[model samples]
Target: MPNTNGILGRKLGMTRVYNEFGQASPVTVIEAGPCVVLQKKTVGKEGYNAVQVGFREKKPSRLNKPEVGHFKKSGGTGYYHVREFKVEDPKIYELGQQVNVTEVIKIGDKVDVTGRAKGRGFQGVIKRHGFSGGRATHGSDFQRQPGSIGSSAYPSRVIKGKKMPGHMGTDKQTVKNLIVIDIRVEENILLVKGAVPGAKNGLVSIYIKKA
Candidate 1:
């Protein structure tokens, strides 16, 4: 069974590690929590069950009065990232409590990681959706064009959801069932067997749910 709780973190980067037999394994390194429980929601009061956790210390000047007051209420220094995780029993947790990676994870555990993917800016259908451009040697000038997008009589305008190019990436994505390769409890680092979305240092949430 998967563990219910999770923690917030930053994706450090990727690296490779070799085993005893000289087999190299690629892993993504994540600087996992040390997250603080900022608030708890109860079914009797909030009509739901969840826990709000905060991560990464922020300067007081960086936050306004209301945000400072909120952190103060939770007895935390301050946080730049705050996220909610739904739980079956929120009463077991309390505010101002620290949530570590070890509590919700261990070696060989499978986890789901959620984060924003790296942005690719404006692009053409060739780069965005893998569309093969027109024949290069041909006299046709339609090299990178998306070609025909709509019918002539049936529909006058371009159809919705057509594979035309525009902006790409920077979307929220989830990578599931990534095996926990290693854990550094003191450094709060988690090394997973496969890649997770997002650029280096981007915020990510790691969850262990039933597979």
Candidate 2:
């Protein structure tokens, strides 16, 4: 069976790492994997091949009856995060099998990280879409406002999908082709070059780039 090539993790924080020549590169630290296979789906039965995995064990008391019953099939363990990853075949993975980060991804591999970006509640076009505000000189009443939204002529209404902002961030974002700088197998930590979506401690899904 082919490797799943995906894992669930948490963004620990960002830090810098240096190469042999002492050149620094900013990297985001993620606590990845050690997820357990909760279920498997096959095309013959479930219409596609995939594996459902659970990460970050949770207490049984916090889960509802249905959740507890579902987890019982996987050795009676509860998880805070559960996700599915597509695979070529689901027959190879057994329920409750632990998948470590090192088993699928390696250093220098290109990966895509998916997470929710930090939310910036109700913002103007100047901050959300990077529109240049009016000149900072005195008596410029058109400071941070979004200016005229629409014209009074032909299309007399606001255009669909206009750049005017209502809300910002807190959206699902995927950063693709980030290089894996390092992996700490003992600590289950992965370091990738450049910034990823979301704030510290946010959940992230990392998938190895298909070649």
Candidate 3:
């Protein structure tokens, strides 16, 4: 196991490609790295150590006053997302410096991705919580209802954490140990095998596997 580094990137979308053995692998294309150092944490001051990173530059006019001031103080351009990763031993990155993706991750390493999933509006039990698909024929109208939320007597109360219909997606999620399939230094892109949870173009936090 190694102390993995973090990178900020955009989901460039998903694609399929063939490997050396002529086997196809599904991959999520992410435009990763070339991130700017926004801030750094140390044991003496912050109690714990970590490095904060910023990515995807934007116009100053698009940011609020507080954001603009923070960027100025941190010596960073206007960036869309900022994330911090805990460093166990010691960190050598400095504020206002660049940390390219290549410097941290190598081909075939594992990483964890965190991102906000796409929003799927108000939904029913079947789609939201995986209730069995409804019957199509005749008068069997039990369909997709949550079905008997509570009983008449006995406990008489609906138990907490019971599955029910509600909002779906639009929640933060993490997918762990996704294999790094390919890396392009020039484009700063990462091709990770299997699905990286989230919608296309969502901001994702990529970190090295922690012990």
Tens-digit lDDT track for model 2 on 51-145?
A: 99999999888999999888998899999999999999788898999999999899999999999999999998988999998887787787787
Better lDDT candidate (1, 2): 2
- Total residue pair clashes for candidate 3: 0
lDDT leaderboard ranking: 2, 1, 3
**In angstroms, what RMSD does candidate 2 have relative to the true structure?**
1.4
lDDT of 1: 0.89
Better structure of 2 and 3 per TM-score = 2
User: Ten consecutive residues with minimal summed lDDT in candidate 1?
Assistant: 1-10
What TM-score would you give candidate 2 relative to the actual structure?
Answer: 0.95
Q: lDDT for every model?
A: 0.89, 0.93, 0.82
The TM-score-based order of candidates, best leading, equals 2, 1, 3
Count of clashes, each model: 0, 0, 0
Candidates' TM-scores? 0.94, 0.95, 0.89
2 against 3, candidate with superior lDDT = 2
Instruction: Give residue 128's lDDT in candidate 3 (0 to 100).
Output: 89
C-alpha RMSD of each candidate structure in angstroms: 2.0, 1.4, 2.5
Cα error, candidate 2, residue 93 (Å): 0.5
Q: Cα RMSD for candidate 1?
A: 2.0
* Model 3 spans > 4 angstroms off: 1-4, 89-91, 133-138
